[model samples]
Target: MNSPSLVATASITSPHRVGCQAGVQIGQACWELYCLEHGIYPDGVPYNDYGDGNLDPFFSETKEGRYVPRTLFVDLEPSVVDEVRHGVYRDLFRPDDLVTHTEDAANNFARGRYSVGQEVVRKVLNRIRKQAEACSGLQGFMFFHSFGGGTGSGFMSLLLEKVMEEFTSPSMLRFAVFPSPRMSTAVVEPYNAVLHASTTMEYDHCVFVFDNEATYNLCINKLHRAIAAIRVKKTVQFVEWCPTGFKLGINSGPPTVVPGGDLAKTNRAVCMLANTTAFREAWARVNLKFDLMYSKRAFVHWYAGEGLEEAELSEARENMAQLERDYEEVDGHDDDLMDNHEF
Candidate 1:
């Protein structure tokens, strides 16, 4: 028989590549699966979300295509919910009126009504529960909420916690697309509280966190208009790869933070799916912390000692420096510093 600790630690790893299907509720649904699959039952006791506590994601993909959305969680704002009730959610569901209940709930949540918030939360959870039940069982979920205004942050974390109560599969993964830091403050305050509560919540699972700040940093450092353009369904794969790749490394043994050029190259190799010459050239120049060498281009070039244009390499190194600065800033965090967990 398995020891108690082993049993507790037992968790699921995705056998195949994971993807986010964003036409609907992406955040809520994606996170559930990411946590469940990635969760590690170290010594048998299941760890909570946020790796330091419990459960580590397993499985790594060498190719960018490996990260795809299987489940999705649509983020409903009070206004959007109102629209849904009067419009979409109803038509999408069935039986009667088409009005957005989520928008109404958003108003209630922001007003900070304990009772109204609970009801709104409950209704949203119920919808998720019903959907999960319909699936018979789920693998992972995609979180599609904007990290802009207050409503998204106020309830996103709470929503995940509630979903975990009913959808207790193996590992629950949470993937989210947060807004840029400049845009997040209005929402981050509330998001901070939610994140704090979520970290402590027992039912909470691993979150595939996305930060608007992080995205912004990438865009600014890389001299790109928007991070999304390069991603175009490519960002999720990179994000998924980062954690899962790290997790897999740990499972195989343990991991140490990779550094210098290795880290940047690894991140670039995984982050960019388009094999454009520019992208390939870019990856060659940057260094990363965890050099799993999980990318084909990385390995091929690594072995061959490929060359990059001097100008391209120079710009890429600047981006790498920015990343290094940002990573260091957030790595040494405490509860007091929680407000700064950018990505």
Candidate 2:
């Protein structure tokens, strides 16, 4: 129940990571994250050993590995396909995963009759629905897209309405983008944003929204000033928040040195490089708000009765003991260290 089974769809990203095609870069990030998750946890990996009732993946590894998630992409843009097929996305996803529409939906979502987007959306979901029926392991579905664009917003609207009508077993979640003023491409973006948002009120169980400007503007002064970053509970994990700033030091001169090594030159050079207006790293402070989740009672009745069949009460007890052992291991394992301390 702690590590929820994740099946990521797609979302936008900072242009620093993926120049203009931040949307597609999100797919690449998902693949990399899926592959590298084990490395993140020395023992910190999320449990994802579900969803494998012969629901054959889009691709398989060289030596018959059992570790692959079912991936499917529904899109209308041929260029998106070209870039993905030839770029980083191809390195992660195979050609079998693509679920492309013949014609592009050009800002006409309000008029769904004009495009094949809805038809394709229904077809893909229907194909997967049959597969899902064979296995009770379809934990959830994650819908991701930018609200401003026609295809993402329009096709997504169709998905939200139809997915509920089609399947009732898996829970629904959304990773939606609240388009910022600068990045929105369509003139009718206001209508799309409101329409998508209002629609989510009915269909989606939970929606996580990320703003464009908030992601791009990375100033330590605003996000995490140096003193605020490393004061008390602040530690090495908080180093990203401790960035000073950045400056236009690309073509700037080599810094002048003080006669007696005053360190003023080095300091000036650093300040010039990080001149308070540059991008600072975003802090991973999402945990701060998670306390609110515990403030209210959860509808966890279904979760209690559902899970792996082999699990037992003894396994639960051993897991608790393992947590106590992990806390001890964090201190590098001493037999009687803090033995006299009060629990």
lDDT for each of the candidates?
Answer: 0.32, 0.45
Worst 10-residue stretch by lDDT in candidate 1?
A: 3-12
Off by over 4 Å in 1: 1-78, 81-99, 102-113, 146-150, 184-204, 222-343
Lowest-scoring 10 consecutive residues by lDDT in candidate 2? 275-284
Q: Please provide TM-scores, in order, for all candidate models, with all chains considered together.
A: 0.37, 0.52
State which candidate has the highest lDDT: 2
lDDT of 1 by residue, 222-280 (tens): 55344445355332233333543222112432322222213332212224322111222
